[model samples]
Target: MTRCRLCGSEALESVVDLGATPPCESFLAADQLDLPEPAYPLHLRVCTGCWLAQLPPLITPEETFREYAYFSSYSASWVEHARTFVAEAVRRLDLGATARDAFVVEVASNDGYLLKHVVDRGIRCLGIEPSVNVGAAARDAGVPTLTAFLDPATGAAVRAEHGPADLVVANNVYAHIPDVVGFTRGLRALVADDGWVSVEVQHLLTLMAENQYDTIYHEHFQYYTVGSAIRALASGGLALVDVEPLPTHGGSVRLWARPAEAVGGTADGAPPARTTAGARGRVADMLAREKAAGLQELSGYAEFSARVAKVRRDLLRFLVDAADRGATVVGYGAPGKGSTLLNHCGVRPDLLPYTVDRNPYKHGRFTPGTRIPILPPERIAADRPDYVLVLPWNLRTELLAQLSYVHAWGGRLVFPIPELSIVEVKP
Candidate 1:
């Protein structure tokens, strides 16, 4: 982009350009396969002014989420993670004792994966989601949902109808919006004047450190470090009170914030000073760590492009070597990140042949740009491929256990991010 989206600065610097590719989640159907598909430039730029890493808003959220294919409930571990988060939030916020009086709202709540727990506690809850199909699924699960995107007007309407939320939970969706400031304000509008807002986004520090370039897709218009996150929240009159490093989606940060008014400042106005006692020392410590990692300046990103190139080269080498040896290699998951990795590495059906996923929505479709066929998980054992390329490597631990049965026929698994590695599994 010519100017940084957050600060409107012209001081944008290059981080990495992963070439052009189609929207990662735009899986093709059998009939549409013969038609031409569009691709967009997938370049990530960092703003010196705000230190916010971002991509051009080539695709809108409506194009990606209107009929979304991802369902959070498909992953058993993710479900348990949501359950734990809800239990902890209830105790931490004392919502359980006043369940009848409390209301929880989750932005971008896919299929009520997290809000189901709130419903179980008898606390009023609502999911604000844009995808009609997934929102329908959430309602069928008995979780109240509003099928709409969260903008300032929508947020205000929700507050007017259901009243302000006691807690607003936004997980993994903060980076998905291009209008960072507007979305944050929508968050502020939805939350109570004395309520809390919790956001979980992939931390840029770990993304660069762990070489997680595949996570950069059209859907995620921006990336954030702790310092940048603080600024983003401040733009919406929310004060950062605390933050916790999480192990989800490679690496993430669960930020605990509140209305600036609740944190001893004016709301819906300019951000207040960062010296409030409500601001914990952990926030400062994380900022120090980010600065130590060279995130505040361009020095931290100097070597990221090279590291990303190495990943592309190493993966191609492995796939080529496997093909020459006449070994069968199928893919494990059809995650959006997989599209970036596959397209960036120039992998096609010839190299991967097909992939499998637990989610049935993608069963009869093909991956976005690579056009790799997606099948049911049972296909892995049916064909007994010599090697299975794991796409959602962020879930390394969980997938290892689920695919342990691959050991039956001397099969192995390949993980391609943070360097390529092949491992034998035992059940």
Candidate 2:
């Protein structure tokens, strides 16, 4: 655990620490409230060798994802993102002319949010999900799914049963795995020689730059940069082909890869992504930018911890001031990120009352550590609180649009991270 996760180097430096906290997604029911909950050290480190930021495991994945409350379908914007991604992949990958039934595989495919789009296109798809409850939901929706952790062995079994995939989609899962090497190598086994592998993860540069410490939790084991991604995927015999920055999850990057052997790899080692002239130019530019920003050195992380500490004080001050004025403040979205923000700031129901979420799984449960009640989004209008704190600030546009009725009651929206500010909603 002390060694760097990507390069296995002994040269690792501390980045930021959130102290001991419960797993963000570990919400509790009324009966379970009486029981003790576990907490672990929440720290991040950057490898001096590969420059990848990561959190060493204090808990196992078995304990973290045994039962999951997140359902992607609950977010209308996320579903639309999936739908558009499918349509583009279909056209760009030449799946229609190549074969309308191109084989597609998605790892950590939660509730078939993206795979359902593949199904609608008549493309053959399989989901490798570890969550038992969510996997059942995917199955009921007519998507073939397997309940297993993906490694080289299981990935081989998947390709054997269902023909080799034309495209292997791993959206936002690279950061959740502890074995970065094994999981990326598994992509090679699950795909055909000429197939493509796509992985989307929150960019580490954006995380520290934007003060997105809320995204830090036990469920996410690693943070990625373009530099680290190349090393991690290459270790698994895959080569990065292309990279695109995305707006999802505050800021993210979608990486396209292919088997190393297909891109002129030697027996000794695999080459990096096959950069066409333009691709090579862009990759070099990005690496240069990261290096210029001191991302490759330990000094780069020095300012982050102090910035995060100030954020906690600022948010607490803002909320406490609002409560003193006798203004009611309720929350929107009981997201995992909200758990980190609430628990870190020592917020209870007193500072912020109940929150709301569209996911019915979390309706009756309390957020981990902070025992704030969760209600449906309808309550925001019913209560018509003076202020509605938007917890998932990354989706402010979508949340604001959906809860447009809040403006009717003269309710203003508040954002905590990056900075504490009030957003005026317009009809």
Candidate 3:
């Protein structure tokens, strides 16, 4: 019954019902288990009005983010990705020598993993992170951060204090926001007249095409295709300038936007060719590809619920078979996606005994409802488990390299999503 977050329309269509699952980030400690845990409807809906796919946040940002457990520093690959973005962004926006006093803002900046690189380059940067402990950590690392959630008002306050931002960067943080219009308007508010806002979101087309249902957790309120994203940005006075497809997060798109008012120039009777085409550039092509893949139509989503069920059954069969044979199976990372996948697949501690995380904050905590023990990597080396289940399959390359010790003991790696992929052990 919830209204669509994007178009403010009641004409919403159900995409999939992942059933009720606990808030993905609410990792619990042993003592906390005695208390009742809250779970919410993980139903996803699509807006017929705007064709945007989204989920009702089910919980407030405060409930989901405050005293957060997820940290970006845990992933070496993600950190490298951030570093690369900084380098390319400086070149793209000409932020290096010319835009010296330019203020760069990162929304939901975690542990200053990305901004630290910007600051190291002597560029002025600010991180707007909502999680208090996470913001303090960013500040501790010398990335000036505001301990506040981003909205239109927060955006105004930051602009008044620090002046307009030359470049506003939000990597994978935009999807987590429920009031994305307000968040986008905020980006439009603080961006310099001619400046641009850059965002990275996992493409919805990719999600549907690849059957990545594990990613449909409650923390992420929206998934965007190029067309839907451009429409949302246009609502907030921003226009898409260009887009680049990325390999990160299964498949993601990096969008560049400028003030809507700044799109057209005085050179002709109409706007520039790029601006006239809704500033499509390569973005129009991407949108056409999405349309060709049937993402723009309603029928594209109808089959997903059945697809999710089949994958769940497949994963359950694998885990049950492994357990019956007395083989050990442990998880690599207890991420939000992992929580959804585990709960959706009805995986319990018996099938997958425990999971390991690099973050010390999560080491003592247990996965939401499954109550799988979150342990340190040292435990894996100690136990030499027969099979290691990689929950964060997006970082499999980095994780496989780190967990190579398991292979030494005749162990193998397992991936559940996009079908079961068992990494072959090299002798």
Best of the candidates, lDDT? 1
TM-score, cand. 2 vs. native? 0.96
Error of 1 at 205 (Å): 0.2
Q: Candidate 3, residues 343-406: lDDT per residue as tens digits?
A: 8888988898889999989988999978889998789889988899899998877877888778
Off by over 4 Å in 2: 98-101, 265-274
RMSD of each: 2.2, 1.9, 2.7
TM-score of 1: 0.97
Residue pairs that clash (backbone atoms under 3 angstroms), model 2: 240-273
In order, how many clashes per candidate?
0, 1, 0
Q: Write the per-residue lDDT of candidate 1 for residues 181-276, one digit (tens) a residue.
A: 999999999999989999999999999999999999999999998888878888888887788999999999999888886665432222345544
TM-score of 3: 0.96
Q: What lDDT score goes with residue 137 in model 3?
A: 92
Displacement of the residue 209 alpha carbon in candidate 2, Å: 0.8
